[model samples]
Target: MKKNVVIGFLGTQMDAGKRRKWRPSVQLCEHPDFPVERFELLHDARWRSLAGKIKAAIQSVSPGTEVLLNEINIDNPWDFEQVYGALFDFAQNYGFDDEREQYHVHLTTGTHVAQICWFLLAESRHVPAKLVQTGPPRNNTPDIGTLQVIDLDLSKYNALQQRFERVSGEYNTLLKGGIETRNPVFNALIERMEVVVSNSDAPLLLVGPTGTGKSDLAARLYELKLQRRRIKGRLVHVNCSTLQGERAMSTLFGHRRGAMAGAQSERGGLLKEADGGVLFLDEIDELGLDEQAMILHAVESGKYFPLGSDYEVTSRFHLIAGASRDLAGLVAQGKFRADLYARLNLWTFRLPALRERPEDIAPNLEYEFEKVGKMLGNQVAFNADALPAYLRFATDPSTPWPGNFRDLGASVQRMCTLSPRGRVTLPMVQDEIATLQRIWKDAHADADAVLLAEVLGEGAAQIDLFDQAQLASAIRICRESKSLSAAGRRLFAVSRLEKKSRNDADRLRKYLEKFGLDWAQLVQ
Candidate 1:
């Protein structure tokens, strides 16, 4: 059985009287429910006489209880720093054996400041003890007081536990740039990231289409780590596609003086600069084979050789790689290194494209509006009629946000810049909508022309615009499917229902023959 130990201040007035009638110390020792095996009395140096009296009284009440008086100097009992420091020093040196003893900190016999300090210590785990507050007897007789134990572990309390969870959720929302994203998949992704970011420094890979906020998420995650003191260095962002040849190698791994033709001085690489912080490599799939191999080595062993250097350098950093394309596909095609992919694939998060999250558009628009307003020093708001009109078009099924968040952000920037006197009127929204439609139409037309040209050479120019649209849809489905019949079933699902014989493959072949194209040619 564990011994019950009670530690408290010597209550100068409450435990001072020679008669044990109203003395709290005597009440604690004589309590029938709680039999304290040991008592540790803390008192000011001037209260030695009172401390001695309390110890004697406690012993008289319970002869089996061992009483020890500890002397502590407190210049001002009300001074938080002085009292807390004194108590903290005592607790630190006291050598508590929690395995064989249960500690109860008595809060009834101290100043309000002391009581609060003790509670803080126990709550923060500076002292492994439970807080126990004692009250005088309800009857006017000389009886034992009431003892209530308070466990400092907040998780045991439902309300406090819920509050912590709510705060954690709010923090994650902030990490996503305060957009209040309503997508379930996106919210769950953020929640998982919260745990991974706090616990591990392993490389994170973000896979998504371009403008899907990969870079933004990486930057925000770095900021979160910095705020939490998990990292001390700054964030080094690298757009891999923008780098080329020797510059790419030299940029990532520092170069010694005169390493290249234009090398005027030694340059410390981004990896070294990001030591103790985050290194976000956007479009990582664009990196060369050699760079990928070097990254793999660095990630595996926190060590890599800089350009034109014989000796290797060390850089311990959290790596976050972003890719708009399928890295696994690139790996299979031998364009990306499989080893590097495996290393970064440990924690992969796929950010959803804007079209996949229509519900988040309105909230994102508001967030973007606020951001632009702060940047331009002018708050902008959409008129009542314009807000719904813009949202209707933005959330429509046919409205393809090919560029994802980048498209939305650019649209907002253009409208806010053109809004008269910070008011986005209905006419302004109509003009923006028209501009977006024209842009999308032109983009689709260009894509169709390119697709047809790739398949039919110059014969693509002879195809009518009406046939081009239908042909492009067929070609896309065929390319995505494993076989011609599979693609046909999807394309002719409604039409095949009208026919008794569902020869989807033959129908698809005939459709291709009308354009003088074969299944083999279109699939290619």
Candidate 2:
């Protein structure tokens, strides 16, 4: 015959009473009819001794009953979301398949809130088990338990799906119908992101390079929240890179009259403007270390004092921080507060760069043309040849979109502007490619020019772009090599094998000589 498996928490009250007594997990097993084949008792980290004693007691009462002690770590047992989430996650992954054996949860143990969570999970079928409420023997009658098997399948509830659809529609508007996104991971991320923004008031950190729609997404989130009546006010956006010192502080926390020079009147800043709404802090990595703590306090407590104020003020608003730089590196370098980083990192999401999402290029290009049509009040279309040619170049590995979507948007803008008669032809595509090449080259020119000029000095000015590009490649190879021979072998991988015996170093020396450079200079 198959036996029953019982899962329960070791109640603190049961563990009390100044003697070795009956814990619920043990009590259920000690019952004559219960006949528990196994007991799984969850215990908080600090009460391991109590759990051990309970486990021993259960084994002593029923020698054949297998007891498994599970340790749960929690900062505060009363935190409903944390506890519920932990238990739900555990149940979600636990094996619920035992062909002959039955599962039961002893609900007579644990805190009231934990009991509620257990019941909810069991009721929702998240935890597949019958809830067992155990009681002690009274007046010589044997102790017994009541089993409740609740059937609450969320799928059976149409209201849940309706609500989900409504929430999804809000986000669809936010994403402009998600025109360019087809990747399964990105689609799943959107669903997860909607759930996050729905309930969380904690700061959200968008980790992606510039032009990845960080600010736009933040604004759209605010709009979604407002549509749901979750937020009552408008979004307040600020680029922290544009802020500095006192001006930054004043802009974020407001300022009293006479707080500083030219402080003619009291001013409500971005934080105040975002009261009951959302504040999108772009380039937040640029914020000074001095301001990091102040922001942290406001985030944690929803309280802050305006500049030159005698009393504290409160502004409770959701925060959305965007950063292109490595905020973690800055934190390690003592440029940002660890506390602030921890808080903002709770819901961090990285928006992939345009180069990383090639599947999106065609749709986004079409979107750009549609945008152009609306802006110019004229229909615009890319010719068959022009469209494919632009897409080929856009998705090529040789292109590094440093500015990401901003570069893509600019490319579309330029092509559309240059496209006469609202039709993008082959000539327009060619011109846009040339413009992009020049733009990308100019962006990277400073670094390359510095390296080349330092190595070649006056000769760098005389060297054409082709030779300079070759020298840069040679220098990169030399830096990566442990010896001149390795660099030479890599540089002339195909040609070096043609030699009867490889004289890589000699060949490398001659190659460097032609550029008026040497091995030492290349490596350095």
Candidate 3:
């Protein structure tokens, strides 16, 4: 019978607490159900004595159990994202090629958060593992206790956790332009695209506001399809919004010699060049009706007539179209071709705006700083206060991020450009915040204040400026929330613990009543 290979970290705190008690790792190796071939114990570099004890315990428990120590470092166990990122990278880069031995992740050891990371990695197939959880006996009887195998997909603790892991893993790669995975709608869209790219060559439509990473995603999808051998040629991209009748026609479908004033040489358009590859049209909704009709035929039949050429050209290519405006509305207004819309509407994925995914702000900020480091040939650092200051305003519901990531990117670009000695100071962050506030409020005509005035009547103008801003933000969050409890939880994240009993809804109600507002009026 082949023995199993168990992999996990050392439980320094747990084992040290009771040295005479039966340790979980020792019992795991001794357990009759789990016969170990080799035990790989990941431990801290400083824990030599602990490692020696663990090795001794394993040897004594099963005598023949082979044990090895793998030293590693965790600079900060409390930083969830950093720890999770390091472990995930380790798991991704680890080699697990022995087919003769089955692998299990011993979850009884390590920090609680570390255990969660292990489960998530395994659930996503990144670690290719099942969980082994060892529990102590019910009584203080001198016996090794019970053990349970956790299959994430089937376990009561996390039946759908596997699905979330699968999605997050892909986002860590595919939609990694920034921390865009925090948006559920955006995450699900990319997940769908993963399947769509592999199975279909039909045109895909990315509908979202400008600067939502549509263009980047289109190129990425093309690259993925190329790797899958779904497309055999290079990507050809065109911005339809920048072209017109003659230029658009000549640019997309190619032109015969002297096809137009500028066609002094023979030219095969982007579509022909994209033969056997992907042709991405950015802001495709801006295509003229004639251009739209022409592209529709090419999309459907894989054939088109180049400018000033009667002979037809065939280009078998996958089409990816991106649009910022509402294409369906344009179709209704007769500005866009309905037939063309129908052709690309098969797989439409909406990329949510940045303000809509506030959770992504910090990761993206760090990512931007990393980019700055790469470009400047030295790392750039943010003052400890800089990040929080920036995020506080970026996440404000009243802030309208007109350019989405474009706006955020420009902000970072400005800050990085202005950083002194590679450090972004609090003053720099505050200046940028004030600039953003002025721009947003000036450009959008204080929509929030207008709404507040309409909602609160004379009370809005009478309220202090700070109170008005707070009221607007709270109301916006409340309106977006599913329930009063949900809204209250968000509003009182720090204060909720002080409550003797959890009645967030009642607290929210009383707060609203202070402003002579009710859930009904605000939510509506």
Candidate 4:
């Protein structure tokens, strides 16, 4: 007898037209022996067109098999659980015959909502379900198969584990073995969190500069917590910068029906949605003082009153907050509340900047190269020159990397994508460095110019003629080419005499001396 299967595609819209028809087209081959029935539970009316196409496909595959294409209006948060429950009920009532055959739910789509709902239903019913995705073929095309699902809540945890393993493998492969070979500081923090996560429910504060992977670390912690508990709860990540005024309250504590003018129905806030797991607050410094107090109260008491509702909702979510700037500074400036800071500082871990971890730069570059190459479907590799140049750029103490690892990653990706023959050269590195310098100068043009003027005195006027940026650019070019003429040619593309005659070389020399560039040994 053929196995009974129920598949749920859980996203806002599940219309056959918008759906990746090719994905389902390939998915149908999974159960070649069993008679498969397809169902599309769309959360929006917009997906009707896609639904029709899916119905047609089902008809082609199995002429008489029942295919249910339904639309659910989900304007509020409560509707999700209700809609999900109804879908499962509908599936069991129409498709599954428990006495005749074993029913298995297969979630082929990569929608997180569907995955969560299916997980809950599968666990409740004690039914076997598997997640399947397409994998690259041994030869050319990609193949489809089931990835491991040790436990239902293990998805996030497993993903982090896999990522860690992959990154570790790349480090070992590239670095061979050296002191501080891996990101020991980051790994050690993770280890400490692993020990503390299960023991305490206090909020975790991941303090680090931007692009230091604070968000990533927070996610891994959430997964680790889930893996430890074997519980079902969603990992909800919210950027505090995106939430403003009323939206902040609604987003955190949820809203009641008619709570405000536009609130038509009741909704579950992120805290409630993330109950039993983790709520990662990125850019925590951006959160307003009132919101910070509310968050602190929730973290302290695990009780919050939803907007426009008298009833108080409770949460069991592990709060993990991250920020690019110093929270203590924000507290000092009266931007952030001290109480909230105290609560969040329970298990604080400050990630070291990329420049501090020069050992990990090469591995990070290699891993990033492979990642970008796979995404772009290109065979890209970094030449030996690329690593040294990137290392110098990333670890330069004088260089200001406001974006940190993210900026480095993006730069590497751009270089790989734009490089000819997938080979990064010294010129490519120089070009990128020049571009970054331009951006930096543009951002700090006023301040930089003032600083240069203050130092250069009478020469400051000449410095002012060409913005501080231009002055800096001229110096960089001169150093790179080891000749004023060549640097001028590269920077302005002007005739050698014109570039030299502009007094740019003299101004650059004076400015360099005034800034103590000689002391810094900036000039080669």
Judged by TM-score, which candidate is best? 1
**Tens-digit lDDT track of model 3 for 1-524:** 55588888888876554654767887788777678889988887888788889899889878888998877788776677866887787776778765766678999988888888888888888887789998776776437877778766565556477885765466447545545456676566777778778788888999899998898888788867876788889888899988987988988888999888978898899999989888899999888888989899998999999999989999998899999999888886588998899888888888888888888777787787788678867777888887777788888887788888878878888888887588888999989988887887777687768979889988888888878888888898898788999999888988888878888899889988989999998766
Q: Identify the superior model by TM-score, candidate 3 or candidate 4.
A: 3
> Cα-based RMSD of the predictions, in order?
10.6, 11.8, 21.6, 24.0
Ranking by lDDT: 1, 3, 2, 4
**Model 3 misplaced regions, further than 4 Å:** 1-172, 178-180, 441-524
Write one digit per residue (lDDT tens) for candidate 2, span 1-524. 76688888888776553443444566667766668888888888888988898888889989989999888776777889988988997797778776787888887877888888998888877887877876655566544333343334556669987997876766764754457476555566667778888777678898888898888788878877787688897888999999998999999898999999999999988898888988888999999877778888888888998999988788888888999988888786578888899998899888888788788778888887787778877777888888889999998877788888788878887777776688889988888889889988877776766878888888888888877778878887888889999888888899877779798989889988988888887776
Evaluate model 3: give its TM-score. Answer: 0.54
Per-residue C-alpha lDDT of model 4 across residues 1-524, encoded as one tens digit per residue: 54444454433332232544344433343435445554443435666666666666666656645566656545443455764765576556555456655444545453556556766776666344543333223455334322322344445687788997775544333222222347777556555665677567778888888798887667667765665674468889999989999989898888999998799988898999888778899999999988888888888788888999777789977788998889998897588999999888878988888777766777777777777888887868757877677678777778776677787788878898787587888888888888877876776566545645554556666644546676555555555665654454465544445553675455545655665554124343
What are the models' TM-scores? Answer: 0.64, 0.61, 0.54, 0.51
Give the higher-TM-score candidate: 1 or 4.
1
TM-score of 4: 0.51
lDDT of 4 at 43: 38
Higher-TM-score candidate of 2 and 4: 2
Report the C-alpha lDDT of model 1 over 422-461, residue by residue, as the tens digit.
Answer: 9999999999999888887877567878888988889999
TM-score of model 2 vs. true structure: 0.61
Off by over 4 Å in 4: 1-184, 444-524
2 versus 3: better lDDT goes to: 3
Evaluated at residue 315, the lDDT of candidate 4 is: 90
State the weakest 10-residue window (summed lDDT) of model 4: 171-180
